[model samples]
Target: MKKRICVLAMLSLCWGVTDATAAGPDLDGYVEFGGRLFDVDGDEAKFNEYRDIDNGVYGNVDILSYWEGGYYIDFLAENIAYDDQAYWLNGGRFGSLKYLLYYDEIIHNITEDALTPYDGIGSDTLVGTGETEPALWNSFDYKKEREKYGGDVEYAFENGYFVQFGASNMESSGVMPYGGTSSAEFPAPIDWEENQFNITGGYRAKKLTASLTGQFINFDNEDDSLTRDDTIGSLPPDNDVAKVLGKMVWRPEYYGSVVALNAGYSKTESDEQLGIVVPGETRNFDGEITKWHVNGSWKFEPIEDLDLKLLARYDDRDNDSTVLTTLDGNENENYSSEIFKTGIEADYKLSRNNRIDGGYHYLNKDYEGRSDSDGADDNLFFIQARNYSLEDVELRAKYSFLTRSGDYTVEPGETDEGYRSYDVADQDRNQVELEGGYYGVEDLGLDLEFTWFNADYDDTEVGLVELDHYDLYFSGTWAIQSNVNTGFYVGFERDYSEDLGDAAETTYYTYAAGLNIEAYFMAEKLRLYAGWDWAESDGKSEFDSADIIDTDEVEDFTQHILSLKGTYFIDEAWSVTLGYVYEEWDYSDDQWNNYVIVVPGSRGDTFLSGAYDDQDYEGHTGYLSVKYKF
Candidate 1:
């Protein structure tokens, strides 16, 4: 509520900008208001609309006011009264200082129709209701809301330099679903606060620009742990982070060279004690990360009709943190990686309408722990070419191959090499891609793309052995008339994995991924769009060992969406817009078929099953809005 008041006060200040002088300042604006309706059932919850509005009254404001040079105001607000509300307001001129303020709200509706057996849904304590029947379960809606507001102030000098100061605050309050080993799944409360402050200064020049920034971030959480049927350390405590970043981009006209450098150092630490972990003497996590990178690209015309380009980049991340160990001898982990990359390419013109270019790239990666199970080092090589030899057709292709080799396999916090498993494993990967774009006609455009990826694991035991992937996409847009336009798109993707290892040497799992298509037509005053997407993925794991068990989990779903909107000009300055939208979600999973469970707990209350998160559902939205612009 305080945030809302702050926003309202800011709005009031904006309106005051027009009333500063008796002569009155120039003011122009428009307001939009509309109504919408939607219906959702208890058993049928729409997770997609968790963060967005499914049904409600909608309103917006767009305004700009100015008083010559004294003061200027601009505000663009959307969904003003809804959960997904946001606005930006910038207005202020004090001597040479300028400022802007903005606010954004994000919401997650979660399950609107959750059936639980507990009361006090939003409070800290939850008491179970003895009702065991699914029909008699208590109903609740879980949601998360984050509110962020910030302002930025900058001072500019006549000599081409500026200094900026910014501060922001974000607060989150919500409930999430979590499960426990000894108890049924339940909702947990969340109350988080994050504050950030930063200062930046930059110098601007005709051929060079540079900036440096420093920031401090603090996160505080009220609910460090949740105590319901089971007391669990469910959240991380307060933490403070500080970082400094610098960036520079330089261009030397004499050699046509461009240089870019970016570097940063960040340290994060939290000393809050967690009583659940055997009440250790030291805090669990204290980490620091340092990042640095430099990139440069140069273009030179050594000869006529020939262009040469050279590029290089170096990036590294170094992590050093105090490792806190538990009484059981368990310790924290750390990772640091570095990369070096360079590439060169050249283009030669065969004629005014033809050109060809090829490039080679190399990348080497090194990590601190070369013996970790997930692979620690990699070297990649690539060569690519493009030929623009045809008047109406252009083609481009690239291929990359790489191999990975690691030292001994081991897991962190333990010295036992026998207990380590390499899932990604020592392997070879080959990637190929081709893309083409055609824009020969003034009224038409087309794009086609293809990609193939294959990975072979040479030495793997009881893990993913090999995988193959493919993707295809085609899209085009054509102008049917000067006042009409239409476009269509289609895409398909597939991935296949084979892992058949026995006991110490075998693993098996397989699946498939899908196709998306869209078409749209727009006229001077009418627009129609439709999209359809479907995906089916089902994989199972199996081991031949008598001690091993086979597992299966399938994911299958399809979504359909259709929208039509048209605007009719009542006059040169007035218009009306009518839009209708239809959406459908279809889901089918084998494991949760008509799932319903009600178990009487050792405590007096009954435990109930959660709602099917992705059940089939359809939605329709219709709106008629009027607008006036002068």
Candidate 2:
């Protein structure tokens, strides 16, 4: 009640001011109040039971009242005096009818997990004595705050000529530690902050338009957290980067309608640090990297029913590093790369309801590792067709081919400097797909799709490789009534790979099916849904050992979700809503286990197989919200 009174008082104050001046500016805004709760359960033993509680009262208020004779002001505040995890303020103005200004500030809190790679130390190596290592895991949480302010002013004439200029600055701060440790173990957490500023100006005419924009970013480390001997040292500070872009458009009624041209330039620079452990001693290395890119594109309609586009881009990167060792050793290494890409595309309408499109792209990259340089090139071409009939049926088909060649470099031995390199050539791939959908039935639909892919790789250092894959899928949905519906889908995929020599090739296959049912009631405000999913994948791969490995897995999962929500109209300017949701994820079989090990590993390889071990996950979220609009 107190909060409501405060809001009403503020609204009344603004209204009083507006009423006094017949020519005053208009005022408008809305306020929202709500809260949320969540819970999670999984089969992996590591995540058998997890709970997160997030509940808060939030709202926003904005006042845009102007004085007589062309003077205006606007103010906005949100999450006002609340314990919730979000807050912000924004306000701006446009003088009379020509100038503009604005500013905003926001803060947020997020909870997540952290996992760091094991630098081949201890029992975490993939080869040698300590092979098949486990990843280190820890729970993480952090808070972030961001602030920005900028605005643009423009003068418009009855003519097509209009000019505008604007500039903005943004800043953010968060916690970043050197070593991938949980927040609980940090003696002193490093404060990380970054700032960016940009300025843009443009002009527009009847047949031509152009704009130029430039931006810069700087990152700094405010506190040092990691010690020299702790495997992770203090992070670098004060990294500066900049980018500039220019765009132009031209449209002449003569050559088949609209035509536009665009061009841009970007550059980045950063100083990076790397830590290595030699025997029992630790060493730190410093490196400087610079990268630049130039790109351009052209678009136009060459015919009455055809559209064409052409694009090209070039990028160059250089790295210079100072290597340091525990034995007071120092050396310098340089790496450079140049990459180029170009592509052309065309789309043509065969009829009023049918269309066809095709594109071709080429990429070339030359990389210099130390004193040696290697190059790789790739070419790709694809074409697709789509047709739509009056009966509510749609069909699509596409085919693509890609060929690539390249050489890669790596470190060979244990050294603070460069050591290993590999050369690769003749890598090619081809793919074909077809899809169709039917929606002629009232509140019912069906979809089907199939894809086939093949790839071949021939390398002198890594041996020859060949791969093939096929995929098929089907889905359909039916609306039992205006408030109820049901749907189901099934898919199958297979992959086969072969290598040279007596090394046995590997094959993998996956099959999945799912069904969903949903019903809505209470004037479409309340909804309930239930679903079941089953999937299985089997494959074999060659481990570090000479022997061939085999893998077989299957998983069945089900989820039940229920939600109830309704809105109550208290008055013309006020309303309230109550809502709740309950969901669960149940898993059965080894398929879930494989997914936990592989998918999570890619995110810093922090796979906690134990996290989802023997149990399923259940979550419940509920919220109540009230909104007032004027």
Candidate 3:
């Protein structure tokens, strides 16, 4: 709707900047109005999937103002009419000039119990009718919707120059889920558009700082292809991109050194005409790609609590597309890659609270016309330690190791004999980290964390042989007086994997948990807020030999959240707010909720869409708002 009338004309120009006159612009802002109610049982589009939060009529706006020489203004708006709306504005002058504007909206509610024997579902031509009875087909909702807007400006010069510019746009239309070829599946029809531009120039000093940048991007895909009868597929085309960037930093205070540099370049292009492949060839497919990167760093402090760093990086990619030939002689393929890195780091201080840090890294890769292996090498090492010499307690530890080697080839009927292609496979990795903190219990605060990970491919004989991960966390906070406060946190996670397929030899497992709680209360004008959250996830898969069959919990889920809010001032600036939100979800999948879409072989040859059995849901929301401040 014309972007909701340009966001209601920028909220009426930020409500006329609080009556722009008589030396106005000295406001502190608050305005809110609300109404919302929802009670969902199962799939209210999975509890408003990407939020529109049903039964509504809500409003909000926040403003900050200033105007006495260093002029300023800030505005914010949220959820005015739904679909996750947003708007923001920032105004200038504190140093020189500044400005910004923004707008955002999102909606991605997929699955409204999809089913389609197609009848132009979202149009780009789809017309299926051989409908093998899916409750007589025709019902759709696998959604998508996105919108973005932007603006920015910057200017300053007091001898530390600066200049900047910006532009942005994004749009997306609905319908998704596509895959076809005899087994069928289609809904596809998302007309996307994107555009962006940027410019920058800078210089700052206290040592030195410099910058230059230029960027441009464009993409358009108005249903590039989707014809369903004789089957035609192909979407996502039309592209263009360009970029250039440079940055530099230097500091030299007579012997204290630091230098940094960065560089970037990019190019991408795509032009249409994808028709005849190799018969009377008159070629097309003139795609292109080019990219570059560079980075450098240096830091120093030769002694006394020592600190040093040196780093380097380089990257490149080129695939100047456009290749064609056939009639038994193959062609029409392109690929490229290059990457290099070097590193050194150190930090030391042995007493007065202890500290240590270390690093070493090396990486290399080169490939051309890749088909699984061409080159690869990587190495990494790390160490870290820190202690705050007790007092209020603080500690940290870290360890890391990594190794990767590759040059394993197989092309010529590609992949299927000792496969090995986990990104050029031959891997070994290990990591560990730990952290702790305590504030000596005055108002109480504590935290703890742990992590570990491992990976090994042991000379791959088919594919991915091992992987593992684990994490744990704990937190606490308390105030108990002066207004009361509380906090809590908990987390746990684990993941494992092993794979090698020829028939069966798979093993996978995942587990997750999370818990959170927060509370706050005050008495003087009455205020309270509370929150609770819990989450869980589980997954499993196992198989052995002799024809498979050891599978059951292929991903299970659980989630819950609760929130409450209360506010009452009625004096200071007038306030009133009452809010409640609750959410619960549970899902299970052993291949998308164990089939039966009107049965008919229960989706064996595909053509099923029960919307994943409507994902369990339970939701409740309530709101009431009124606020004013100056």
Best by TM-score: 1
Local accuracy by lDDT, each model: 0.68, 0.59, 0.79
Clashes of 1: 6
Clashing pairs in 1: 50-109, 499-507, 501-505, 501-506, 501-507, 502-506
Report the number of the highest-lDDT candidate: 3
Q: Candidate 1: global Cα-lDDT?
A: 0.68
Q: Return the lDDT, model 2, position 359.
A: 99
lDDT of 3 by residue, 401-465 (tens): 98988876673234554544687787889999999999997998989999999888656767677
Query: How do the candidates rank by lDDT, highest first?
Result: 3, 1, 2
Residue 488 lDDT in candidate 3: 79
**Runs with alpha carbons beyond 4 Å of true place in candidate 1:** 17-29, 40-56, 65-72, 91-98, 115-120, 123-138, 180-184, 272-375, 410-424, 440-442, 499-553, 598-614
Instruction: Give the TM-scores of the predictions, in the order they appear.
Output: 0.81, 0.66, 0.31
What ranges in model 2 sit over 4 Å off? Answer: 1-30, 35-53, 56-190, 228-237, 257-260, 271-289, 300-306, 320-333, 370-373, 407-425, 445-454, 460-575, 584-617
TM match of model 2 to true structure: 0.66
